[model samples]
Target: MTRAEEQRDAGLLDAFAGHLALQRGLSEHTVRAYCGDVLTLLALLPHGPDGNAPADLGALTLATLRRWLAQESGRGLARATLARRVAAVRCFTAWAQRTGRIATDPGGRLLSPGPDATVPQVLTAEEAAAVMDTAREQAAAAGTPAARARATRDWAVLELLYATGVRVAELVGADVGDVNLAERLLRVLGKGDKERMVPFGRPASDAVEQWLAARHHLLPQQTSDPGALFLGARGGRLGARQVRDLVHRSTALAGVRDLAPHGLRHSVATHLLDGGSDLRSVQEVLGHASLSTTQRYTHVSTERLRSAFTQAHPRA
Candidate 1:
């Protein structure tokens, strides 16, 4: 039996996910979703060819696959849930055939989900202002130098996120050298480890100045060394988890419950469109590989329009 024949279905799914991570350079979340889709397939198939022999996933047919999906739907999976699963299987089957694991691709006929009609959540100008105000105020409350330095750091973090619309991972992954304060630009390593230069506005530049000036006061030990742009309490390189917690802490202190860092990112895109920024530029700033992702903000804009109409219109 061939290597594909010898490996169990679960093992193959894991290997495929690894391929996505190592070769395709996909992020952890995308890898997980892909693995999960194959897992759903594995569960539907009968257990193994014995350990030494190749497992017969070769029997996958359009009918069996459709039936499996139908069962999944019957279990009350949402349209989006069903849609992702279909995508997962399609990706796997394509890969499997290309890699010669399967002679026929099962996903050639798989259908995609309908367009996502749900609107994305976005913060209003007032709420965003409130959150920023609270962060600045909290930063001010800490009388110690270290505390004040942290406030500067937090402000920079919030400001950049709000301005650039980059994901939290991209933000924390940024090195000190990647920030070009003079040019008002930030270099980010986004999904797939792709590097891109994104620009921030004056507010973010001011925040960066404060953060950098006080940065030495915060991590005075680093005079010659240049590393991650953000540092944690330990003065070492900051991790993504810490940044996430930092945003969460600021939100909680700001009295905004159920708010996520991405909300601010979303706000940036929405606010830009609301301010007459074009869809293409918003897409570029957000590092979206597809304009379709950025187009979601238009839906957000429409909802805001409807809201304005409801509040302002004097209809009977």
Candidate 2:
């Protein structure tokens, strides 16, 4: 529409962001991410698109794009981050083609970044318990000694995430009314706003009930309420930032140096598989839109075989 990244209309990025917001109903965060991803590619362009090369939107080639990605790798961007950038580029070019800005996407044949294949990091069981304990103490010190009750809430959130392997975004998006405590199920709202109801074990159920009984202390109203299962101190509703900050701060206090918000979700799936839960079951609990995404949790094949050989062979 604007002459193929021609005039550097400064408003182009904002326009795309607005389009994402209005047309896709994407969250502000997502719109920004998409825009950022596209801008990153534009920055990598030689002499830019409109003004310079127009053959392929500034004659950007697959090799050129790969070089940009390689530069990103050299700069020490994490594999996951680089992968996201690739995906972002792909999405942007697709959008460009769809919107008729470019006849063909330069990113169409671009290869995905290599995956790091590092077993995703996570908190050990004891470490997770310690983090929960720390959060409880903080909540208690903040006001009432409602620590156990508060801890009950954190534990439910932590355990359910770990046990069910759902994303923090999904967990925070859960609603009080959506959770069927009697049935031990929580309806998780996922990306693209897809919904699924996942069942949890008794420990998670007990913790959730404790939180529910004390829920009024956290959320004082239900009429026209936000209906979120989790709440922040100010008490509107909890957000992913709050959840990540909660985990980060609590784990730091407990000295679990490598914990992350998604770590608990990773731990859940890995633990389930370790405890002999089938891969399909783990995949479903994780709400992985695909099975391949869930397979990363199967960190046992090589390690397990080594352990079996070492134990059974006379070499040891």
Candidate 3:
């Protein structure tokens, strides 16, 4: 595309990003992914007579959309990636049509493979207990107040993650006021900026209380958000990456398969189902917008059941 065309498309993407964030309430991470996908799609549009690909939103025809997906498929993009890209394009086209940037939404007719059907890996109850135990042990072993405080915080992080199944982002986004220790409840802001109250067990509550007591030792450093429930060693609001690293480190110390924060999320969901919690209640706890999303835990539970029956059944 020409310089002018590139500038125009860039401006369009910026607007689309704003709409995604402000109007659709998409998370910052999701908005970036969608915008990047759309930019890639635009860059790959067929070049026109003047040696510049058409920059007009109207150039996004059904054929063009299909061809873009086909090229991505040829490049061996995974089914989940292609599915996300398709969703991004569809959202763009719908917005374009609504805003009169295009005459029709061609992306409506575009089809791509759905998300992968693979079940997410999760820690068994035993492994989860081990992870928590390891974290607590680490905290107790710390000699210095600073090290002890940080360790305490990590213990709380793992306990809360496994206990409530909040996404790492949601965990980090929470503030001190969001916690109701007396009731063992945490207020979390989840995807699309939706808020919910998730209850945790006594163990998680005790860990958080200990962390709060030691939190000041990690503080008196530069930070604007003092009310943040979690803080880094440098006293800034804790980040999602830090939370993820802690999860991996804790799992490794526990000698279990290393897990991310989302793995803990999967574990909590599966364990809840295994413990006889209803799908709708699990869905509410996880802040899932769709029941089908919550239903995946059922598949995990069923798989576990099948494995047990195959091992112990006499009929086999």
Alpha-carbon deviation at 71 in model 1, angstroms? 5.0
Summing lDDT over every window of 10 consecutive residues in candidate 2, give the lowest-scoring window. 48-57
Q: Which candidate wins on TM-score?
A: 3
In the range 147-170, model 3's lDDT, one tens digit per residue, is: 999999999999999999999889
lDDT of 1 by residue, 113-208 (tens): 675676546677877777777876776677888989888888889888888989988888789999999999999988888888999889789888
Model 3 / residue 213 / CA error / Å: 0.3
Q: Which candidate ranks first by lDDT, i.e. highest?
A: 3
Please list the C-alpha lDDT of all candidates, in the order they appear: 0.79, 0.71, 0.89
* Deviating ranges (above 4 Å) for candidate 3: 1-8, 46-54, 221-225, 313-316
The estimated TM-scores of all candidates read: 0.82, 0.80, 0.92
**Which is the winner by lDDT between candidate 1 and candidate 2?**
1
Instruction: Give model 2's TM-score versus the native structure.
Output: 0.80
Better of 2 and 3 by TM-score: 3
For candidate 1, what is the total of clashing residue pairs?
Answer: 2
